[model samples]
Target: MSLEIKEQSEVSPFLSDAARSAAIDNKEKEIKDAQHENDDIMCGFWIFKGPLLQRFATETMYVTIYGVSGCFMAMCFAYFSGTITTLEKRYKIPTKTLGIISVGNDMTTMFGSALIGYYLRKVHRPRWMGIGLFTIVIFCLLNCSLHFIYGAGEDALKLTREFGDLQNITGNLTGSHKDQKLCMSEESTCMQENSIWGPQLILFGAQFILGIGQALFIVIGLAYMDDNTTKSKTPAMLSFSTFLRMLGPAVGYSLASVCLRWYIDPTTEPLIKPEDPRWLGAYWIGWLILAAITFLIACLMTLFPKELPSTRARRLKCEKDDIQNPMDQQMDLSLSGMWCSLKHLATNKVYVYNTFASILYFFGYMVYWIFTPKYIETQYQQSASMATMATGTVALGFSAGGVLLSGYIVSKYQPSARSMAAWNAIVDFLTVAGILCYVVIGCEGSDKLSSMAVTSADSCSASCHCEYVHYAPICSPNNDTYISACHAGCTDNTKDQLGRTLYTGCQCIAPSNSTSVPELQYAVDGPCHVDCFNQFLIFLAVMCFLKLVGASSKSTNLLIALRCIPPEEKSFALGVGSMVASLLGFIPSPIFYGWLIDKYCLVWGKTCSNKGNCWLYDTQALR
Candidate 1:
């Protein structure tokens, strides 16, 4: 390809001399024209330019807040399954029925995201943002109402029991005598029986709405940035935007943690009986606030001066001119272009290796994010707050390391796309080492709870207990005790036992002198230590890092690829690359993560059980 291009360029280089002077004159004129056009645009955009950063800052803030709210809601939705379990126990609904609803919600959100992406591309940015936010607000309002209804019903149930109205409650609460009989016999026919289903549906619906909002926000924001910035400045602006997007989640999670601590009570029963309902109010409140902010930002987006003069005016002027019609430049959404780009990418050995390595890294990451938090919670028996803090710690490490190292490398080495790819590969390799360390901790059965407690004390209050303890059957030389208690005396205890207590000038007690207690540690366990529940969180975190690296490198590589084409072909090459990424690289991501999680867990379970440590087969052991 290079040789062919060179030969063509040589033939066109006016080696025959007559066209050489003409070509030079044309090039000089083109440069001068381009410079003059740029100056005209710049001068017009600059009159109110000082406030641009302020606008950017405000928009960024709103986006960040909304980003956090969206994530928190998603996590809440994910954890809603736990709420369903509680609701089922209280209301007597079949678990399978609830599972169907949960799965349905996820599917709906996926479709919603794609739909939103398509629409955002089709519509104006402000309209898209407004529509997305409005949808979210409506859905969230419905969700909040559902939660209130459910809570009221639960309150009524308590009121009836307290007032000795149980007998009369049968007819009013249950639909018929048969329902009363079923309620008494099966203990599942309460008025709030379908309460959980409502909120879940609402959440699922809200997720779809939020997904649309997110897609609009990202796509429109990127397009706006691209349209407004100078060509030379676009890459830097995009990179900065990506950085902010990444940072937004971390900041949002941190703020959410603080809010949870301030408003939520972990020890008490949830306001709606099952724990899931407790989070619903808080979740909706966050969404409502975020939705308002999003709406405001959507309104503000209208203030951004349109880059081009009104299209309607231009169309009118064109009609008056009766100019010859330009070629209809329809968007080419074809497989052939994608295939060519894929072929081009594959032919470049460095890019091929980097891309595959990125996929592998993301696979590992998705698994880690999915399982790690649950592993930390179950293995260490820590509180949700603590689990979040632990995960945040790791995330902080990643952010810090990425920022520091990437900046240093960019400053010092000024590496090319291939170099960035190699560096990213190295980071993935190092992440594997971190995972191994976590695995070792899990194997050692070290005190993950105490360690996390200490780590979290800085972020959380001293009174907050973050330890998660799992009680496993301990085989001993003496008669086997049905229950073994490992007590960490962070709080006032009703029972006292013998154990090693580690403390930081606070009254603390550990499980008594029991050898070979089924202990699990997180920091030492690596990715192997993450439990089933947390596998998703681990998987998400890992995938985020890997994707960041891959996407960044890919952008640079695509630019390099564009350079390989003739000047007139550059735009075509770029369009082809984008099509390839959207078609081949985008579609299978979810399926790949799902497969990796299932396969890894299956393998991990088999290995753990076959090695004669059946207790280790527990999903918590990995966390």
Candidate 2:
């Protein structure tokens, strides 16, 4: 019995050592397996599936690509805004028609956002975004193709007569001007040669396609960012992206200013100066640049994996922790499941309130965004290029700064959702008050063209056929502006020392009691001086302030919407919110503002007897 016990004790030690070795081996295998899983992802066997590729699969990399693409997208829109006036002139589109074209994007969003938001939740997000961007590339090319299709209509002053020829001077100015000859002639009606429908349909179609491409940016992009980041870090990341996005407009408007300085058709030299109201800018050049950048962005977006590396790790951990918890289960894809998910959101009061607030805000905000450049041009008599540059540099720059500062504060303090809401409320009230100031701001418009009120038979130059002239104005030294040199009764035109056209022998400059001025009278080219520089400066200051305060709420509002929804419904909520906002806000805002603008038109450029673009606006009524 003693010998058997001694043998068993020695064997027991060997068995125990073997067991410990096996356990250690198993643990080491698990560690290696986990490391392997994290180091590599199953995106594909192509370039997307490499250890080297994994190095770039980070939040920082994602944010960078997203920001640059966002900049390009924003640049396209800003360029459109900057060049809208020139487009109006080039196409002979009235403000009301222009407004209809502007709303085409929102119309698609109003219908498609809900579907995109809900169905795109589990798909490869970056690849889908890439598809959307590709569509945008198409939109850019298509929209700009209009200029190539229809040439920038002939310059208004392109005369067939030789220099010093006075015959047929009282003819239709190229699109926007009229001149009167010393020799009186019978009036003739101009024939309608251009079709407005062609240009209008093309623009609307382009914006509609653009709307489809923009969905990914509005819905998926936000959710992707929030998913990859911690709750506390999300605001900072969003602010960074938005700040970069805002820079796009600044650069875009600056580019517009540069492009507009050149004639509409770069191949041809313009006879009329850019200072003349008839100038058409080179608006198509920027679209080609935007298309090339978007193609590169598309390639980058496709290379990213379905889920980011960090997000994948967290998701795996979460699945393990909540393996038995039904409430933590992933969303269901069945029809009934979707209905239930939607119902859950429908009942969510916080989401409902936040969405309504967004709708109201966007409704009021889009008008200013779409028309500010045109407003600046008409109200202050600033050039289109100057107005666009100012809107982008001063207004959009201050907005970007405000968003960045707000994000920094939120990130540093990690404020609660309620606190964010309270801050937004204060900002909202301040915004309303600031916008009201624009109503009180004022500037005098062009001297009412007295020629329009009188018949040529009763006028000082009774023989002049002024009825057939266009709406181009000529400024007299008396600070009065006539509809045209013909209306001013100028018998001859000559060049000045500075090379500007000078009209001489003007009968219209005589005092009210005198039949005509006996002395030689003269006037210069272009409109009379508008003393609104001081008022414009004040308007700019107010605009800067309003943009600053209004933009501060962007991050806060987004954070509030995110926090109020269930984790799985983040994308769906954003999509639905955007859909509602489009239906109630963006879809109608531009049209309403456009109609209001058309109502104040004092002089419309006539295109074959149909009312065309407004040459002059009632500045007071506009305010």
Candidate 3:
């Protein structure tokens, strides 16, 4: 030790301590600069790479674009859902058929997400996201094209022409003739083979395209944002993005409500008003708007470089640090290694079990997400637009708040894994309870909607087939509801002072008061007022509470899955888990629920010999 100290002292006289320290600092700076240069060199060809444009390429900019893209995606889904009823009526598609159509997006995502997540890990993320957004734009355009391809719908007031012996005789039987919207004695015939399969397949294809875009949004966009942003700020950024996404449903539904108020053709007047059950709205207008917005987003996304400069430096530094204390071997992208990784993930009991739980959870919950608009409209006799707007606004608002509150609670409390699991279980139990409450909270169906096994005919209208009747319900003074004015056996009709069609000489209608003349018994032009406001209120309350409680546990399952796996494998685990959930849960939930809904269909509209869309539902079974 003495000999080493003497040698160091002799050498120290040749070089001052300050000069030596400066030399060491200079060497460290040069190494860091060299690493940064190498990192910059790794970026592939990109737009807006000039220094001026690069100055604006910040994480904040990326998050903004990412959030807006998410919002647009949510809007597309919400708009599709909000207009589902109109689509059903226009296309003569059964609920069950529509259910299967709804799953097309999930089917594609289930098969494609894992592959994309794994193979595209090192690609230019922003450019890929842009490409996905462009695909979505095409999806929107294709959906819009269906409206043009089919043209405006058939007129509801077009009279059914009866040939043979009864043509002239039956034509003069009623003041208002046997139009498509009224009760008639003639049997329905297939004018032409209305090949609904063409439209159905088109819609399914569009949704399938939508799934590809959504997969990119989930697998790439999120990872890119996380990689570029500071870890501590990520949660808040995500919450804000979620908040924006929640707003999308409200905006989308509201837009649908407005668009649906116009006639399907927009340029021409329609026989039926928006309130008429037979009305087909301008549902395609929303898609056009979305397509334009998505195109703009795609352009913006393309402007982003492969990686932000600061993030590149940070990533390089992290790689250097990781080399010193490696926790797991680097990933092998080979086919055998892929199989090995999948097997390893499958063997993780906690991840596997949590995935199963997620599948079940999504299975039960997706039904409501996909069908609540139809449910509200059917059960409460609410207009489609009103039901959609109301549900979207209230439900999404509460859900956003719940998610933010849960994030705050977790951040503040730093709960243990066991506590988080316990909380999730409690949330699940409450969600089940809420669902049960929904089962009992429904209102009675429309009186006119009551299904009769035999034709809806009595002695009053037995002679008038009533079998060919379209759903234009009438309400009598005595509150008796009839399928249509003709079904009520009304011999005459006149316009009231308020321009309302009032029917008299009705055999079916009873006088509200005995003092009224028998011949003066009258009926109105719409269904009897179903008092379901109170019940609807109760349903909304239960639904909001369920959303709040259920969303509170949204992150818990993912957290558990991540903690159970190695850090290097967490991303792969998420991809696999998503695939499993979509395959077992989302892909089939809507189809099954749609079939259940179809089972309660009381009056299936006729399209030739084939069963068309349901005109009326058995409310009791549906509830």
Candidate 4:
């Protein structure tokens, strides 16, 4: 029995060693298998036996879909901003009324309501985005005949010539001048009607459709990217997507700038040069083409597996994404679930703070985007093509570069929430300095012109009555350009041998800062400047650079909001934040900024037969 026990004990050690060896061999095999898997990913021999398309597409392809969607949306927004002035002129939309109309675009979120976000969370994201884009296409096509079908263009322009123009000039002028022009311009008791609803409604309705697409495309696409991809890659992917998105605006505005040079119908040569503020173009064509492209992108986005087929760890992460707030469990998928998640988001301090900063930043940006072109045109009297081109450069080159750079920096550092806040503050401070440049950088706008109510009040002729509403500007003999013959106080017009328009008997023709009163009584078409184009360009360059600096951030605003919320509420948090920003920033910015712009009006131009545009502005008073 003792001998048997001894043998058994001896065999136990050998058996234990054999078990250890097997474990070691199994581990080595696992290592080899992992290496093989990695090799398949990297090598050309990764022959897939699965579905053809699905085998080839990486996670980044999904990001590419988001990028394409954003790019097309950016194009639409750029088109809208670039052509707003032309639309205002064509539609006779007032600054205040236009603001109201802009607000109508954000009706989906109730101008920042969280309902859309909650709803999207429940629905299939790509499908919702697809449907929204499809609706956008339909509505945008509907707007094709907006000007032709609903227009009173000729009538509106004449009405302004007969009345609204006088009200604008007389209202700004002193009592005696006001009293004098009121009789010739219109009845003193006359009430100019608010916006006519037909054309305005068309714009509002089209924008509302666009707004839905915008909300769905931006929020859902962004969330889909985040949810499907690893956290480490999100910033880089987002940066790439945003870069493409910004490229859209650049391309759109560039095209619009070129198109604006020609008449609405390219075959029909423009009567007035592009320098004339009266120039309009085929604005509808841009929407038509872009809509087709966007629709295609939306369709392709659906091909990406609804939820990316994640590995074990990624699947676990996504399963958590399905969790509702308060407990990391499966979402209830009910009204109660949405409400609870939204409440949790609203109370998140980091989210709330980040939201405020974002909204403030958006406010400055929205104002800049909407008005920079207008400012360029009015401040420097640049042609629409030139102004839009410059604006596009900023949107494309500087702004896109800034966004990409910021995203790179964030990816490199992966900043904490506090650091992100600090970065935001610093960027905004720089932006303020850039914005303040508007107060001084611009030259005084054509003070020698008859439209300069401050400088040419006495020279303005009540006799011409400005009945044509034609912005055929003229240069006084002293070399200052007047907006038109009527502004030069000309009693009669004569055609030169070349058929160029001419004016005689100008009252505001005295030499400026001269020793003796010099009489230069006649004026002719085109502007006269004493060599300031170079200086104007310098201001624009400085403006672009500084604004670029001000606009860029070293951190991600989206990440800030996302990190502050529970994982389950990330999408809902973004929605609420966007709503808040639109409510406080985007919705009201145009209105208040437009009002500020209205303060600088020198001459108002009517659209057809209604109240129209301020054809001329006091550049110095623009701030």
TM-score on alpha carbons, each prediction? 0.50, 0.85, 0.84, 0.79
Model 3 superposed RMSD (Cα): 8.5
Output the worst ten-in-a-row residue range by lDDT, candidate 1: 520-529
Which pairs clash in the backbone of model 2?
156-174
Per-candidate clashes, comma-separated: 45, 1, 0, 13
- Residue-wise lDDT of candidate 3 within 275-378, one digit each (tens)? 56777778999999999998998888877766787776676687888753222246578878778879999898878887898798889886787788888888
The order of the candidates by lDDT, greatest first, is 2, 3, 4, 1
TM-score of 1: 0.50
Model 4, 1-623: lDDT tens per residue?
67445444444354577785665566667768877544333312224223665553466776776777777777777777777777777666766666667666666644434666665664556666676667667655766667557543543333233444454566632343233222134422322444567778888888777777777776676676777677788878877887777777778788778767655555443445666666666666666677688778766665554455553245656567884333235567688887777777767777777788777777776677767777777777777777778888654578788878888888898877688778778877877776676566645444334245445434255544554334555677667776665556654555689865566656656545454342346777666653446656876777767645654662376667666676567667767777887788888888888887787777675533565667777665564
**Better TM-score candidate (1, 4):** 4
The global Cα lDDT (0 to 1) of model 1 is: 0.38
Candidate 1 lDDT by residue in tens digits, 400-424: 3454344444545556666755656
- Cα lDDT of model 2 by residue, 420-486, tens digit: 8898889878888988898888765432332332422255655666654565567777667766676
lDDT of 3: 0.74
- Using lDDT as the measure, name the better of candidate 2 and candidate 3: 2
The lDDT values for all models are 0.38, 0.76, 0.74, 0.64
lDDT of 4 at 368: 70
